[model samples]
Target: MRLFPQSLRWRLSAVIAVVSVLVAVALSLLVRTEFSRMQLADARRVQDERIQLVVRDYGLSGDATLGAELDSTSIPAELRAAVKGGKRATYLERDATGAWIWAAAETNGKVLSLKTSYADRDRALDRLDEVLTIGSAGVLVLGSLLGIVLGSRLSRRLRKAASAARKVAEGDQETRVGATIGTRPRDETTELAQAVDAMAAALRARLIAEQRVTADIAHELRTPVTGLVTAAELLPPSRPAELVRDRVGVLRRLVEDILEVARLDTAAERADPVELELGEFVRRVASMNPDAEVRVTGEQQARTDPRRLERVLTNLLINAERHGAPPVEVEVDGLTVRVRDHGPGFPDELLREGPSRFRTASSDRGGGHGLGLTIASAQARVLDADLRLANAPDGGALVTLELPDRP
Candidate 1:
């Protein structure tokens, strides 16, 4: 009763098959009806011709021998009855006196009998019907099988694309849809897979950028803040209030550095570079820490943001004093500054972390948030300088800042 199947391929095949069957059935019926009519007409013509021939033969004998010739022939008994009963085989005879007579006789006993030769035509029609039925059934079965094969291949490709997409959604950026060589997908599923890969790539880049920014911000804020807190808690009550003012000044500088780093991270503020004497700048910074001897050995003039660049150098100097053994050495090599201190070198682990926030060596003596190196690194980046930290072979931490030489 239900002719169509659920699968698309099967349903299409079924529809084609059903149509073929109906067409075959209709043609067979039409052919059978026409054949039957033609056969019946032929039988009638043959029966009429035989009856006429027999009657002519009987008349030529000049005798009214009705049942005599009928009994002597091989004509069936039923056909003989039809001839005698006058349903068929009626003959008209005319005499020389212009009188006409119609006579009917039975060659045998039955009525309306047809010869058995027509049975062959019936058998032929039955065979034709059988062939049509079998051919149509075979075609339907073959078509259905082909449809299933094609549908399964398409489904497999779709499943592969779906699996790849799910892996990407779960943060696996390396996953890719497996495509056969030179076989491009031409459907919506392929497009979806492409879009998913793009999204994963974008997310990976953004996450890395955010991490770098966070590390830079934290490292920049740590040093000055630690100094300010220490100075505040240790200031003597009997000393002139001017000493307290100096401690407050340190705190203000720390707050300014934090604000500046925040603005730089957001791209809300940009650095403005100007030409300045590099030697005078380093010498002025060294004057700030009178207790420590700061050696400057560079004479290169450079164009850079004076305030920001100065802050970068100041951070490096303070870090050296806090962590290094003694006497910080600042040497200028071409357009680069190398700050070396006689101290225990950085650990291997710190070197691998690159520019990270709150990175402190376990051997460090001071108690403060580890943001000095991170902030200095960020400032160097903003100024388009390369800052590298490594351990000197003999024994010391080496910090290098390379800037572009002014024309």
Candidate 2:
């Protein structure tokens, strides 16, 4: 469907090839023109020399039979007219005998004409043309090859830099493009690599500072939250007391979620791999939520950290149940667990950017801190699983978790 290649390497090669072809064609035309002119001039010179010889012989010996055609019609009408007017002239003509150059001039009231074969010059010109054509083709091919090599090298460097940038965006702070580029010369690609490295370093530092602040705040709130919980429990039973206790519980959970995120950010969670009957494990997790409908397509096994997977699935179920419309479904097929909710699907921003902590769904969709899916995704990563979030065709949020079946 594409008229031109999308790849930069091919685009560069094409550009160079087209330019080379144009240059070759232009040079060929110029060379051909010059060569033709030179050959014509040489032929005319030979014709003139023969004409001079015949005319001199006729003038000295009074005989025009020195291999000269007197008033010959072999000479063109224009050439004959010119000689009759006492003017010397030379002309080229081609016939069955190949090519000829004729020279004529007035000699004692007789037109003395001489002719010579121009086939040798024509053949030489043909050879020159053949050589030019071959050379032009060679230039085109060589230019294309050189363009491919240069473009490939440049594209490879750009890919490395882009990959490093992607890793950085995915929270791999240690990834650096400069390391991949090695000791290359400082060109545009090298500058881009350097820029990416600097950006990663800055982001890494800022993320560390943010994580430390979050962890410290959570740690500081833990003791006070515990005290609040105890105080709420001791209060006399009433509506206000219940509300206080509920809010205190919410606070405690928020602190826990923040701590968990901090730990995940630090990459401190290690998976304890265990072989699990994936269907049964999913059934058990889904059973905790009576509203969820669990279906197992077939028996399957996975080597993963069950605890982390449990956390991920629980979060997904809670998110769906709270935000989505009724009929939250959990389907286990192979090593994949799919959770779907007939809600307004995920918010457009959420689908575009994934989950961000504390960024809750829009008021129209549902209400909660957005940490559920974020924590779920982080835990899924710890289990080395693929967690994808998408909107179901019929309308709802669909979250798929695919676990590794092998160690």
320-359: candidate 1 lDDT, tens digit per residue: 7788767677776556777877778666776787645445
lDDT of 2 by residue, 1-407 (tens): 99999989999999999999999999999999998998899889877887888888888887765477887867878778777767788988788878988899896677988877788888898999899999999999999999999889888888888887788788776678888876576798887788878877887888899999999999999999999999999999999999999999999999999999999989878999988899999999998888899999977878899888899999999999899987999999998899999999998899899899989897767788899999999999888899999999999999999887664
For residue 100, what is the lDDT in candidate 1?
20
Q: What is the lDDT of residue 248 in candidate 1?
A: 74
How many residue pairs in model 2 have overlapping backbones? 0
> TM-score of every model?
0.42, 0.90
Error of 1 at 30 (Å): 54
List all candidate RMSDs to the true structure.
18.6, 2.5
Candidate 2 TM-score, C-alpha based:
0.90
* Pairs with steric clashes in candidate 1: 80-108, 84-105, 84-106, 219-371, 220-375, 273-304
- Report lDDT per candidate: 0.63, 0.89
